[model samples]
Target chain A: SQQGEEDPQALSIQEGENATMNCSYKTSINNLQWYRQNSGRGLVHLILIRSNEREKHSGRLRVTLDTSKKSSSLLITASRAADTASYFCATGVANSGGYQKVTFGTGTKLQVIP
Target chain B: EAGVAQSPRYKIIEKRQSVAFWCNPISGHATLYWYQQILGQGPKLLIQFQNNGVVDDSQLPKDRFSAERLKGVDSTLKIQPAKLEDSAVYLCASSPPVNSPNEKLFFGSGTQLSVL
Candidate 1:
């Protein structure tokens, strides 16, 4: 079963505008990571925020996690045409025996127009 | 430092035919995963391996699908008597040891399979 669900299945914005995507999960998670994928290409790791952390930043990307609500959001400041891609959120759950498995969200399709 | 590697970027096969995909994880990485991604959907974990041992395969369709990581470095996924609905992108990924909290996953370009 999938643990995360991303809102705004599709979004279109002009370059230089900010893009925001939200994800909600059903179970307790150890961490949540975001990834981007270009058309017909492999996924690239973007950012990861642990459950203990509330906010994290890397370059133009910012991620926030709210454990109380079981939701996370990713914000891209000053988006560019090159940022057009699909974004997905993956949740890592700590299981018995110290093993962890990641569950991915459906993803949001972001289209940045130049 | 080579990334994960997969072969035959694309494939087409008729229903009930068999197909196999291979993956080679990064050196010294102890975990490997196989995921299935349908059109306009997130990748679903089919199986996970810790070195050469199976860690999780509860979602794998055991009757028709099987995988093995013989040397703990390279792995293969095989689908016998494939179905039309089995058409999707087969993605291979790997991560470091379990203790690392900053572990980042590396993914391959994936093999797009079309079963007619």
Candidate 2:
């Protein structure tokens, strides 16, 4: 079963605006990572926030995790046309197999209009 | 460093035909994964491997799908008598050992399969 669910299945914004995408999960997670996929390209790892973390930032990306709600959000500041892509959130759950099993959420398709 | 490599960027076959996809992960990575991404949906985990051993494959349809990482470096996923609903993008990813606390997966450009 998919562990994460992202809201606002699609978003369109003008360049330079901020884009926020939200994700919610049902189980305890060890970590949550975000990835971006350009059209006709592969997934690129964006940022990862551990369960103990409240917020993390990388470049123009800011991610917040609310363990109490089992939810996370990704924010892109001053977005550009290059930021147009599908965003995904993946959860890492510690399985009895002694490793973290990863599951992905339905992605948010973001379009940055120039 | 070179990223994960996947072959046959696209494939099309009639239902009930057989097909195969291959993956070669980044060097020295001990973990590999195969995911199936149906159009308009998130990628779903099909199988996972640690070194040459199967780590997780609970979601794999054992009756039709099979995979192997014989040498622990490259892996292959094969489907016999494919179904129309099986059409999806087959993605391959690799990550460092699970002990690496912040390990991230590197993905390859997936093989897009179209089962007619």
Candidate 3:
């Protein structure tokens, strides 16, 4: 089963706007990571936040994690036309086997109109 | 560095036919994974391998699907008697040892399979 579920299946915004997407997971995790995917390319890792961290930022990307609520959000500031892509959240949990197991969420499709 | 590599960008096969996908992970990456992504759904992990050993494969449909990573470098996934619902993108990813925290996966372009 998918551990993470992202909210807002699709969003269309003009360039220079801000885009926010939320994700909720069912299980405890060690960390959560965000990824972006263009139409036909592989997913690119964006940022990762550990369970002990509350928030993190990378350039125009800001991510917040709330472990108690088992949720996370990604905020893209000043979104550009090139920012149009599908964003996914992946939860990392260390399994009994001592390996980190990653499960991805249904993604949010953001279309930035130029 | 070269990213993970996958072969056969796309394939179309009739139901019940056999198909195979190959992957070559980034150099020195000890952990590899195979995931299946259906239309509109997130990638579902089918198997995970750590240095030529299987770490997890609970989600893999063993009855028809099987995978192997020999010498811990490259891996292959094969499906016999593919089902129509099995049409999806087969993605291969590699990362540093899972013991290392916060390691991000490097993905291949993926093999798009279409079962008619």
Highest-scoring model, DockQ: 1
**CAPRI-style docking class of model 2 based on DockQ:** medium
> All candidates' lDDT scores?
0.92, 0.92, 0.92
Clashing pairs in 3: none
| Tens digits of per-residue lDDT for model 3, B1-116 | 99999998999999999999999999988889999999888899999998899988999999999999999999999999899999999999998755475488899999999999
Over the stretch B41-111, how does candidate 1's per-residue lDDT look in tens digits?
99999999988999899999999999999989999999998999999999999987544855778899999
| Residues A6-109, model 2: lDDT tens digits | 98899999999999999999989989999999874579999999899999999999999999999999999999999999999999876554566789999999
Candidate 2 chain A worst ten-residue window by lDDT: A93-102
Q: Which stretches of candidate 2 lie over 4 Å from their true place?
A: A95-98, B99-102
- Which order, best to worst by DockQ? 1, 3, 2
Best by TM-score: 1
Give lDDT tens digits, candidate 2, residues B29-88: 888999999988899999999889998999999999999999899999999989999999
Model 2: residue A34 alpha-carbon error in angstroms: 0.2
User: Model 2 — TM-score against the truth?
Assistant: 0.96
Residue pairs with backbone overlap in model 1: none
* Candidate 3 or 1, higher TM-score: 1
Q: Clashes in each model (backbone N, CA, C under 3 Å)?
A: 0, 0, 0
lDDT score for residue A64 of model 3: 100
Cα deviation in Å at residue A4, candidate 3? 0.4
